[model samples]
Target: MPRRTGWRVCSVPGCPEFSDRGGKCDDHRREAEQRRGTARQRGYGREHETRFRPAVLARDPICVCPGCPQCSDPDSACARPSEHADHWPLSKRDLIERGLDHNDPKRGRGLCGLCHASSTAREQPGTFGLH
Candidate 1:
């Protein structure tokens, strides 16, 4: 069943805290980050930092979430400046599995910090206590 549109208890199995952001509460969120390790450890390497990320950001200077909420109209592209070069449609892991260059700028879109965090929390495995 789909979760209702409101705050809920923390996603960590026995935790009693509440959260309105990612499913995990603050403590679990911190713990999960510690477990997840650094960006380099997760495969974001020098090529990503020096090439892919900059290229994507230069190509898309604004947030590109469909119907981005940062704009006055939720049906419009966001006016907020982009802060992240995000992998899209195909996740980095998916691209690698398919033998495509995971750091290709064409595989990414620019997103504001808010949009990036929201999408990461929602879509990334092991986030929100799913793993």
Candidate 2:
């Protein structure tokens, strides 16, 4: 039997580092963290708030982060003071591929800011290219 190398290139585009965890390298991890930080700072826009508030409230204000079941109560399990009404249904690339016209109210979905930013980043041409 031959020894099999488990190392692989990072999943993040343009990165050169190698890793076995999700194919992401240290640089990608740092880039992702920076992007998340930027997204958190921007917060959700007025359109998202006005349009998705009712839907999010109706479903019980929550963080919506995978593996996290916390509500949106700042004083409770949900430490985050604000919860973003993320586009749950459509992905960023899906929106881009479908064009802006497809991002109609009828196609929107809810998600937390963190998850939303992460999803949106996937559609960008390069890492942290959402600007």
Candidate 3:
């Protein structure tokens, strides 16, 4: 049946850790714990981190934002190192609706934090009718 919550030995066989947080002991929290509602719940799991993220980073090592902080000129390049792998369409809402496929090589853009934030903000429905 269900193991009552409190304190117990680690679920891992022959392990010695324990916790009251859940079934898993302290050491296994990162691997065993699942956030209530987020991309993880929606299928963005360890596979994405272990495989998809690295592949994406390797594919595009630089931010591809165009005229990022300001669009004064179309040819401007941010050239900042990519700190985030952003969706090509640049909307997480759309990405969720479209179902995130971390494996889709062409679906993302390597973006710096500033550029990614700016682009995402611009995609909102009220920014200069950009939606």
lDDT by residue (15-73, candidate 2, tens digit) is: 78898665578778887777667543644455545655556544535554443333444
Instruction: Locate the minimum summed-lDDT window of 10 residues in model 1.
Output: 122-131
Instruction: Give TM-scores for every candidate, taking all chains together and pairing residue i with residue i.
Output: 0.72, 0.34, 0.52
lDDT agreement with native, every candidate = 0.83, 0.54, 0.66
RMSD vs true structure, all candidates: 4.9, 10.1, 14.0
What residue pairs clash in candidate 3, if any at all? none
Better of 1 and 3 by lDDT: 1
The candidate, 1 or 2, that scores higher on TM-score is 1
By lDDT, the best candidate is 1
Select the stronger candidate by lDDT from 1 and 2.
1
Residues 1-131, model 1: lDDT tens digits = 45566678998899999888858898889898887777887888999999999999999998898776445688877768999999997877789889999888999999999888777876884453222
- Candidate closer to the true structure by TM-score (higher is better), 1 or 3: 1
Sorting all predicted structures by TM-score, with the top scorer first, yields: 1, 3, 2
